[model samples]
Target chain A: MPAHIKNWSRDDLLLVAIDEGSSVSATFTQNTFCAAPVTVAKEHIASGSVRALLVNAGNANAATGERGIADARACCRAVAASLGIESSEVLPFSTGVIGEHLPLQRLLDAIPQAADRLCSNGWGQAAKAIMTTDTAPKTATRELEVAGERVRIVGIAKGAGMIQPNMATMLAYVATDAAIEQSLLNDWVQEAVAASFNRISVDGDTSTNDACVLIATGASAPPSANPQDDDYARLKAAIIAVHIELAQAIVRDGEGATKFVTVQVTGAASSEEALKVAFEVGESPLVKTALYASDPNWGRLVMAVGNAGIEGLDTGGVNIYLDDVQVVEAGGRAAGYREELGEAVFSKPEFTITVDLGRGDSREHIWTCDFSHDYVTINAEYRT
Target chain B: MPAHIKNWSRDDLLLVAIDEGSSVSATFTQNTFCAAPVTVAKEHIASGSVRALLVNAGNANAATGERGIADARACCRAVAASLGIESSEVLPFSTGVIGEHLPLQRLLDAIPQAADRLCSNGWGQAAKAIMTTDTAPKTATRELEVAGERVRIVGIAKGAGMIQPNMATMLAYVATDAAIEQSLLNDWVQEAVAASFNRISVDGDTSTNDACVLIATGASAPPSANPQDDDYARLKAAIIAVHIELAQAIVRDGEGATKFVTVQVTGAASSEEALKVAFEVGESPLVKTALYASDPNWGRLVMAVGNAGIEGLDTGGVNIYLDDVQVVEAGGRAAGYREELGEAVFSKPEFTITVDLGRGDSREHIWTCDFSHDYVTINAEYRT
Candidate 1:
């Protein structure tokens, strides 16, 4: 539906109505100044049975104070009325320029149109409609046979900038046609999100409206949702796979991103320390720009590692590798390393940088993108 | 002295020799992979009677393992031989690309030339000689009357990228023509550096070769060096003022910088918390990009504050200002704020962003530069 909420040029409203008796679980941004919609959605999801999700792009109803909360509730009520469901069974989400009030009347007038257009194959359109700076729609699907029944999981996500998710992405929804209990669904969603959305960062900025929801429709009644069942394990793997693909798609479509890179850190004192080192290297602007230029600057890499503030980190015990090419050993330029070798790795569209701390048996990794001139151009001209 | 350490075209060596009784206090980078020169300098400065400083700008003797340390000590020995001082009394410093071996023979051949060129008026030339990616030299000076005697403080610094200093800048030298006790000078240097170099960040990457040294010539000894003395206070203020001027100049001349910004966080639970919020706002890429474009993006400002990870922060009580223009109040857009007002403020080459947490009485501030297209270009092509 073209609500003309942000402007008169684009379609920007999407509503997803789940089947009755579906179990829902979600995670929201850890930002203290979370958006009004996030607050309302959290309260509504407490009942554990969400029937629909209403998302509007172009104006994130955030930093708008008391009136913003009321506006989010009003939109949820409009969607619920159109779907013939209670208001408490609907969740509302908004994304776009923050610190703006929602266009209530315009959004309300389009709710029925959105409900009228909803269909089983609307996932692609929904992904595009919820995009702010995303260059393409992100959607992933996985299917498997469990207990002689076909189980399917589908996921969609939308984000470009402000892309460091503390607990969730800017906006994501994963649905599966397999019966699962609420308690188990909650644990599975957290585990899937941890291995997927939480491992990617386009920029280090976390948004005010990040949220990821998982719905178990129970339309395909699998044999069991118990932890000890093979069916449960198979379904969980499919869900995690779909979530990872959707998360990777968000990074691939990141605003002005030219290259996709993976930062892998190993042999740390703990997983937390390893993550700290990976993030420091992944998010360093100098390192990102070097990646963009394909310079293979190991100097900036070592500088980023030194800046990670790992306690009692022995610089002499650290080593680094670009894919399979060993660039650094014992914290210095490897004797056999050549500039051309590193350049070959960094010139690729996607590559991984691995750092070995040589301290313990812990590891972590994250995916990120290079910083380009176009990144500055897009963000500088975003609100204009 | 153009020793052709990095290349054949540039003059990149400097030497400073002080009077016999000069008291010196210094700080080194907290980076675990600190440069070989930093390690040697720390050991030498511990003697409390440093006689000379040797600085080379072309190649940072960092991440070269045991050979790097030996090369740094060799350079110090050469400088000491030329100055007719103990090698242990000479401190060595290097700045430029990291993870590279120093050109020991070339640097040794130039030691005599550097010593011959060391004049009292070479501060400006020394500043320019120590630059790597910096486009301009940074120097600051102050003169005051202490105990009816004229005293002077002079400072020079060089840094452009990889400049989020943990304890000091890439390289800084400060000297005073007053009598100062070693203990007093040590305390004063820490205090001055904390308020100056520690409060600025160009990028969030810290270097492996950061060092700051404070020297007292004791040439104009007409007053007491005790902290309780008025003369001591007067001289300390002058030294701090010079340090601040040099620090701000580094930000003003930050690589590819078009604007200089100050982020001030007030009403935090403690000074550390205030600094955490200040640096979060100061170094946020989205905020910096908006600043470069001269856009009035208050939403990014609020988002940065929320992402600061301040425990139990009440978002509703936060307030933000662009200079005197109230952009945000009570965690939302200010009732009377106009975009034009914020635009006017951000359009200036220098501006201040103030955030009040409304939780306590503590405050802190930091200086930063905007992220521009050239920042990416310069870092991408730096080694090339």
Candidate 2:
């Protein structure tokens, strides 16, 4: 029942529907030039209850002006007509090439068949169908007991590049069988995403069609509406765990990524400064290239730390570590640091670069991937 | 008579001397972890009249502690001993690998030899000697008439990577024969640098060894100490022209650079905002890679614009142009745009990306180069 919405040989369309009275919380891209589908989805998600989501890959319905909005609405209308729901009850999502319009007729004709073929076991297939540049599908699941009942949370995301998510990822659908209040779900989604998707960057680019949805189906749970309840805490932990897994998976499968890098900043004067230092190190092209080459180029690390624009940052007080190997101490090459030790650590596929600002106790960390030659090949040759 | 300083196979030391009354102005890196030579040079230049400059390649005495300051002073002392000038009259510069100590003995031994070999024709050789990863030497010259006297301005610079100078460039020395006052020369140097060195970026990394010095030897007649004189204007224009030429040459010879790009941001609410948008688009890895592949990826362009974080930026008013072809209009694909047109423009080795913010009347432009596989190869394999 999957349809080739963009006329590609592969299926590029997906549809997800939930039961009535389900609570949903979603976040969209902070990009001011968000896609048409994002515009439509934001409006529909505001209605408090949504029944379905229509996602199409290959042609991101972004920068298409009024016609793109109309196209998104038409697709939502077709999905609604087949599912016996109002158009506003459906949220729309699109990802892929930006600045292109959707093939309305192909999508319209396939909505009915997609609706008829919808099943609970289609989560795995849905993950594959939503991919654009992702080499593999990203999906995670968590199970917990809430109020003596089984609760399940499943999440699927698709993003390989243009991945520095501001508010959310390119496209993610997280559904939990546990019942939760709308307000709690909203707060949980924001917190979960902030600590997960927001802490990763592939190329430091924020996409125009990023969206993350959290759904509470209320199909198998003792509904708990109180924020102070133990059930709320349990469910929140489970959801955040799933989100983190998905976020890490995205980084692991990042486009042309050869290594997974964790940049941790400590001893900053403030949490904001720590995060700034961490991201400055994580997203630095020089640092990422060195990671790809498996080179222990600690000079670039110290340079990135200085470039973080920290006010009154005492260079004499900074220290950097490559995993357990102390590479830089007091802003210079550590006396005990050996080239072979640093090289051994950088040769790994995963490593952490810890920077102590020697300012205060604040700390933050972010995950990133190395810049590889294939990164150029994938992005440059990508027709989209 | 050039001598090896860092013990490289080739000569790595350079010396330049001027008359006793020469007026000198200089700018250093904004990086908090600036090199030891930068600190030493700051102190020396504060004495108002510098007689000589000592430059060494193959090692940046950066990230060194108090030892680096002592080493820099020792080198200055050697230069001053050979030239019979005070130690404070000699400015020192080091550029190459970061976080390494200088070979103080070799540098000291080379100072007398380098001073003995200093000549008017050493500019070209000095340009080549200062190079690290640069494929070619960067040198520019301009001649103009000031008060019916011919004045010559010549500059030499060396930087292939670790660019994005905040206040100055990575090692540039410009000398003019026209006489100018210290304060006027200082103001001219700042204005000239802001328009030249500060307007270009190769890797968006500000080096800790960045230094640019402007020297007026007071050798020619008609010493114009007044900023309002016609001679001052003529000399200033020539000096700025030479600075622009050297800056562009650095970008043209950027490490692994294949295409030269200019990003122009216009119609912003302020020059600062316009510059921010220009640098954001110019330095975006996605945009640079697309330029490398000759792919007309306007989607990435808009994404970069949105990522510039201009508060309340009206996307509908944004427009982007690839050379003469308007790729984006009103925040969307222009109605008259064609894929082939964009491809044609991108395939060129030199082109401009013009972003019209449509906000106010401010505008700014910057020069950059494409990020290619060689960029990764060069930086990743750099031993330093």
Candidate 3:
């Protein structure tokens, strides 16, 4: 991530500086066994005017009890002191092994160096520093004309499994140089995440340290705050577009994953049911492995939908398709569908599965990666 | 699995006939998309007298719409006609591929042969006939003395993945010659299954065709039906023991499995919470793969427990052990615990993970298997 830092080193850390008077909105994981840094970040974000994000990698500082929280606060204080800012204004983030305390002294020593190295170019390193089992750093950028002003939005995220809606075990940061209200920023962060990071699965194991933060420097001006305004719509679209790209990148580079899949479930009775069906297909080990092997095993999709525990689900009204190949229609193998056609579509690295429950007008979609042997190799042999 | 009938054949079918007036009790998958045969079996079992079980493997008559139900009825009628019994006295079971109808003529032709081959010593063959991706046929036997009358119990089950509680995508048959009332037989079947077939998992997917049936031929006399009666208790204990053993055998031979694991969650606020914890650990891909590699990655267990969605879970009150080696104490690494010790325990073919939530008296446990490369290979490459 950092040229000066060892690529294989586990003691990775990053610092993100916010311009003076900048507004910040953040979302923290709701898991009870949250990392100490998550607890610290939540408190600091609540302080209203967060100055920076001080992140450390290698040890999650989770389940270390009270001492872990103390260490997290200490790291924040170190960063805050160096920046001449209040300790409560600094948010801390950590990823990597859980249940280990922070190397407090070593971390404190690095804060000054991390701050000294901070620059606009640091975005690349920042993304790389957050990775645990991830193979590559993920970053996305979008430029939109807001109120005739050049507005730039950049987003970065790191995740490799231990992912499932409810914020997925990931750390994401998005910063926009556009003037926006803090309350609106929080709402937009929630909205963007719901359509992006929140709709992806790598093994359906939600981590205990997921956090996403959005910062607006207010360096560039936007036209309006009204929802129906074209300028507001453009800004929101650009932010979500960048977030989706960053989110999709995580699924593409998922641990041990070789195929990127999208599960789209529509015509369900409700959004929740549709989401359940989409996630059921996306997160199913059977379905993921089939995609890994490029095997057109459509039956597993049926099994997953059935197991979604949806009340009064009518199998007879369900239809499934693998890309353009109609594999299952009206709850059975499509009349004209051949095994070879199904195989042809599945052999691709990217494909979409469409499931129509034929009940109502609800829909949901989720991105996922296949369960491959290399994923087992990376996760099983690697300590992350 | 039956020779002279292809082993690689997906068209799996079996029939077990009892001497007459046999009392039958059964459990089916609670998954909404129950197969046609499961629907038929439930109705026939309700008829109060089940003389035979007509099971088909390979083509699971599921999601085939109304035609699937008709095929199941046709199968039952064929078996009944050949056995010279009422069609309502037959319970049908189907396993293997979903959304495919049985080759009606071929299956009907085989029913006569299956009935002809039905003998007192066909328990082994019956077990073998029900296998899908299972590496080996699973069977267990129990002999007990009730009211001075010797009773024999034989149980057989076949499952690998798509295995979850209630009752898992499996076909298990347990037959006993002990005299018991039909009503008590149903009650005992539910109780025994709850503790046996319902406490093991190979994967979290619940199949649409899971069925477990218990047969009491009333050939030998057991005393009374009351729970206080020693004879009834003895008979119930013997049946459950065999059922559990059969269930465990399935896990031991889990698809791509190299290690058998027992996850025991204790001290939860409620039994449901404990079960949620146990299943979370058992079904976690990270935990299973770590066990597959014999790696002492206890953090995955922490991640799983934290993500179990348990309300107000206290990490500080948690303790974990790998077999006799305590890895976690009060939610952190034990003072005397070493990675090598955990490695030694995990390297074994079988081990137990004891998680003490340290909050309440409720407890639950489940049997599981490690996820391995072979599991991915078998599930991905093999045709279901």
Clashing pairs in 2: none
Residue-level lDDT of model 1, residues A1-384, one tens digit each, is: 678887656779889999999999999998888999999999999966699999999999999899999999999999999999999999999998999899899999999988998899888788888888888888999998877889888888999889885776679999988888888999988999898889888888999998999999989987557788777787899999888888888888777899999999999999999999998999899999999999999988998898899999999999999999999899899989999999999999999999999999999998999999999999999998
Task: Output the worst ten-in-a-row residue range by lDDT, candidate 2 chain A.
Answer: A1-10
Candidate 2 vs candidate 3, TM-score winner: 2
Query: Clashing pairs in model 1?
Result: none
Ranking by DockQ: 1, 2, 3
| lDDT tens digits by residue: candidate 2, B178-233 | 88888888898999999999999898888888899999887876657466777677
Candidate 2 lDDT by residue in tens digits, A190-295:
9989988999999888888998899998899576646788777778888998888888889998889989989999999999999999988998888889999898
* Residue B169, model 2, lDDT: 57
Cα displacement (angstroms), candidate 3, residue A290, comes to 0.7
DockQ of each: 0.84, 0.73, 0.72
Model 3 quality (TM-score): 0.97
- Interface CA RMSD of each prediction in angstroms: 0.9, 1.1, 1.2
After aligning candidate 2 to the native by TM-score, how far in Å is the CA of B188 from where it should be?
1.4
User: Which is superior by lDDT, 1 or 3?
Assistant: 1
Local error of candidate 3 at A168, Å? 4.2
